[model samples]
Target: MGDILLRVSSSIKTLIPFRSVCKSWYQVLSDPYFTRNLSLLISNDYSGKTYLVQVEKDLISSPTSYSMKDDIDCSSGCPIGSCHGLLCFERNNSETYIVNPVLGSDDDLVIMLPSMNTETEVPSLFPVRIFNLMGFGFCPNTNQYKVVRTIRSTLRVYIYTLGTDDSWREIEDLPTDRFTSCLPGVYLNGALHWLTYPRIESDDRKLEIYCFDVETEKSHQLDLLPQLLQGRNNLDGLKLGVLDNCLALYIKLGGCFSNFDIWVMKDEKCWANIFRISGVAPLSVWNRDRVEPLMLTEDGNSLIAYAEEDDERRLLKHFDVRTGKNITNRTLIEKGTITSGRRYTAHVATLMSPKHIMKRSTCHV
Candidate 1:
């Protein structure tokens, strides 16, 4: 009975209802060991199939819509990060939230972070500052979900524990003098990874990888493969993402180069060039516009790229990385349609409950 239910709980949709069968079932499902194992199972079972969540006018009603607010200010608000079945959104550089879109409800699980502008007795400049980087990740050691916000102007970083009364706590300043990229951080292996530029300017501005541990709340630099930085003078036209459970770098070449190179960090020290798409398909079809790599298919053979046909239209195209051939392309949205916002990332559904994760907090507010 319990074992059978656990086996079928690979899908979050099924796990949700199974927990409500009775008190005993709920207890069994809520066990930390059970939840951890279930999360791993879910991750393995659904490694492919990334969702392109569009923020539309009627966000609550649209299946593709993930924005919590129907009238959210898209100019100021955007999906900053996703982790452990939760999405973090920031608005006007002050308001932040963590939401589970699959749950389809904002009543209990939705965490509204304290205003980034709130004043304190010793407040110096944060009240007048704006955060440029935000990320969300789960700390497996603490069994907690945390939101990390960085104020690039001041080199200040703050961490907020979800589902707790604890307010935001400022962490140590980033070691690097320069700020992070406009792109969101990639959460993997209990850490949030970002590409950052150095403060001291050079003829050729190089970028470094910075990672923050969710549990330790510490920041460190990650060395890149020498091959990755050989010809690249700057970080422009490069994006960071997770592929096959590892950190991946998508480098888009320019000036007569049509295809982008995909490099995966095999370990902390080694990078492997897993895929390179060259020739006609992408270069000819996409022209010079940027084509963002969303995610690889479950089979790991095909890769999906998002391309903008024009200001009014966008399309998602699949390519066979092995043969550098275009597999298929589909219209992402219609023309002249104003969605609440548009963002894409790799997502993995999990049965880990936020309420349960934050239930045994030992830290004081």
Candidate 2:
């Protein structure tokens, strides 16, 4: 029964209320693995996920109305990424924070990360990563969570392990400084992959992506490209996101019209066409305005997306993925919330204590 309660609970908010139902509910919530398992469940389900609206003061952030029950007052931080129920915040250009929103509305759950370098914020080469190349990932092997950042101009990589490392440690830099800030650090299979900058020096045969393993702390390359991408106008449409806890590549490909095909990476090597949309939906276009629900739904037939209008306004849109059929479209996300400089991503509130990831008696970094 304890295991069943753990499985059925969607979010930390939902799971907590069940504690009053029975002792089994309380025990499940109290388990040391509760937050960790809850984070895993959210990744697997992807239904109760919240699209972060913006980060306010104290690194406290706001999610869409669907997920905004807790009014947290935080400031001076921008979102880096979200992983395992923790929101990564970049503040003051150098310091990073790991915050667990499920814990409550105060700064008690905030874990201040060590400064990477004295380097100031890199100027905006493109829209994203005006700060730096940053990502947050979970290593399932050792049950560890790590934050990875790369100095924008130098291409040098640094890593910080929660519950273990007291300071940020430098790692080997990428072979080339050319990397796309489009989809910064895409976490998958205990590793983070960064899409290389397209068409460097006009050498455009095919660009391979850079992969860094969290557990191994080493970098490698993955040739996970499809033949359709060889002659595409812009590689921006070919986006990478997590679906069913796997690396999913969705791009506009040839069909009767421009069709969007979602390919999932299997065994870390092969790509399988698991979902296909008959026509391109405007919301599915990936560009400066990051699209929410980045991929197809679990059923592989529908996608809930945010459509950007001509007046530079975004609207909540629901439509069929395969046929470009519109179900409904309206303004769901609040106005003035999803703005520039704020990185909006999906979030699942978790009770996972940020301190629990620490390995030492005291945090030095």
Candidate 3:
């Protein structure tokens, strides 16, 4: 019946929840044909009015021409990740919503989490804090969407499993004194890697990289690049990312004029360098705010940074990751003071979409 339905129509195939139909139906849904069709449907549903900004690139940003007149309230927050063209987002108030922008299919899945203060599910009293630094990744092994959130100062690990009806589960506690706010959590090698500030008072300046295995729920201490750790005398200045599939650490050195260095770890060896920004009068002009999300562009060859340029404007800067140079400088959108606090969203695709590939292919034409 599943195969017959799949042969009859793509629309009807999506109506049946493959995971719930049967083992055979699940296998059929995971088939290449079904998945590809699903991706196309998802892509078409999101391409309109929603766009991913290529930060760190030189592209002229257009002014906001269309307004959200209907005002489908997304005040909870904006959607960030899109899988099969379905966007996952949380409102500013932690109300989760999955929307297909093209199809206009917006489903709100609100789940209440335990409050740190009361430790109980209170109605309309305690608000759930949305950890922006938390990593969102889809686990294929478990066929589950896992959201890993680290409590700001305490290193408390909370995993929100989508399959478990978005229930919050408190995992093993890490060693105390782990201070991470807006810290990036890198998912690599089937584990979540984060820079941790160890508990030892004497080695307060020392920064340790810790890895939490998603499969085993175990934590292991990773060796920090000695060159990077040595310079991290102050905890507030270190930045983290993955460069060329390896751990990349950026350290801010304080002086009369500030200096920042980038270190990449490969096969347990660390390569360090100080990046120079061209067209800048003085290198000191590059402040801590200059570094952004460091995202991969639609082309995957370039890295993008989206940040605010002024009170009235936002800037998207693009860079070539291979050469460590700027490619394009584009502003995504600029708005007046009245719309200053409004949020915008971008989707990060794990699997390259054919539509995106074709869209990029047209660039040369």
Candidate 4:
């Protein structure tokens, strides 16, 4: 029975129910060895799928059109980060949640995070303000899932371990200058990476990557490629994502130039310009300055993107990386307005449970 279940673990849909069959089956599915092998198999064999989470204008309810029937309603918050099929949301700027939206019929597993006092005093007219950036990721070394948050005003960082009694532990301070964007962090290679700018004293203002290792609770910086640094003024047009298990940067060259460039990090210090799409209409027509690279196609030939036009129409396009052309005529999403805080990211469902991975210590009061 265990061997049969292992064979079917490749499909996320099948693996979910398999764990519910019996106590022994649940244990087998949650085994560390089985979880690691299953993740690799899905990455190699599964064709990636993209889903859009739309937060209503009310800023409370969010209905996701992930599938025809999968509806996620968080009346208090908006989703900000996605990792390993778990969605992390920030509600009222004071609390957070980690939820698995695809667990059909079985009530959604929602983990409410303990509130933290992030308020700090600024010199402005409004003396007290709160600025926070949060990220969610899985740490393999400890087999635990963690949420990392950085308070911008004080540069203080806090980490919350899922299924553990630890509320939020203060970690090392962020070493970089104030991060320019409030964007969610991208999880890759057991770390969370965010785009940030250097301090005002520095002459070069081009954006750099700020990476935080989940296991070590440490921070590092990755410099931008020479080509990107040349156009420092256009930093707002840049976005980051993962492609083929590597870090990728998507930059839209606006104005008369109607195309965008995709650069993939080949090594720690090397970046390869993989694709350049020319004659892209959405680049010129979009009210938003940047377009996000969602995922690489199954065959690894085309790249999927999400962009918004001047009229606020959201578009999902498929660009053939090899030919640098928009090959697909069909629009994945039409006449849809993406909500302000709602995020759409690549999610591959898995049976790896946070409860099983997180080690319990003392309970929080």
Worst 10 residues of 3 by lDDT: 38-47
Expressed as tens digits, the lDDT of each residue in 276-296 for candidate 1 is 776312222224344667666
Model 4 Cα lDDT, one tens digit per residue, 83-154: 765667666656877665545223335667798666652323321122345788877666667887654445
Per-candidate TM equals 0.72, 0.71, 0.56, 0.74
Worst 10 residues of 4 by lDDT: 40-49
Residue-level lDDT tens digits of model 2 in 1-365: 75676457544566667667776666566455555433211111112122333221111121233333343334555555677667776666578887666665356667887777755545445433322457888777677788877555444567888877878887766533454544457777688877555434464645566788878887787775657554224455566677667887766544324566677788568988765545454223333333445433435555555445543455544556556676555454433344433333444445546765564223433
Reference-based TM-score, model 2: 0.71
Error of 3 at 345 (Å): 9.5
Which ranges of candidate 4 are over 4 A from the true structure? 1-19, 23-68, 104-108, 118-132, 151-154, 201-203, 229-233, 281-291, 308-315, 333-342, 351-354, 359-365
- Candidate 2, RMSD to the unseen true structure: 7.5
Off by over 4 Å in 2: 1-14, 17-27, 30-76, 119-132, 173-176, 198-200, 226-233, 253-257, 278-292, 295-301, 309-344, 359-365
TM-score of 4: 0.74
* Tens-digit per-residue lDDT, 42-139, candidate 3: 11112123333212212233232222222223343444344433355443324444443333333332323333332343333222232233554545
Position 69, candidate 3: lDDT? 22
Model 3 Cα RMSD, Å?
Answer: 10.9
State residue 201's C-alpha deviation in candidate 1, in Å: 2.2
lDDT of 3 at 234: 54
What is the full ranking by lDDT, best candidate first? 1, 4, 2, 3
Best-to-worst order by TM-score is 4, 1, 2, 3
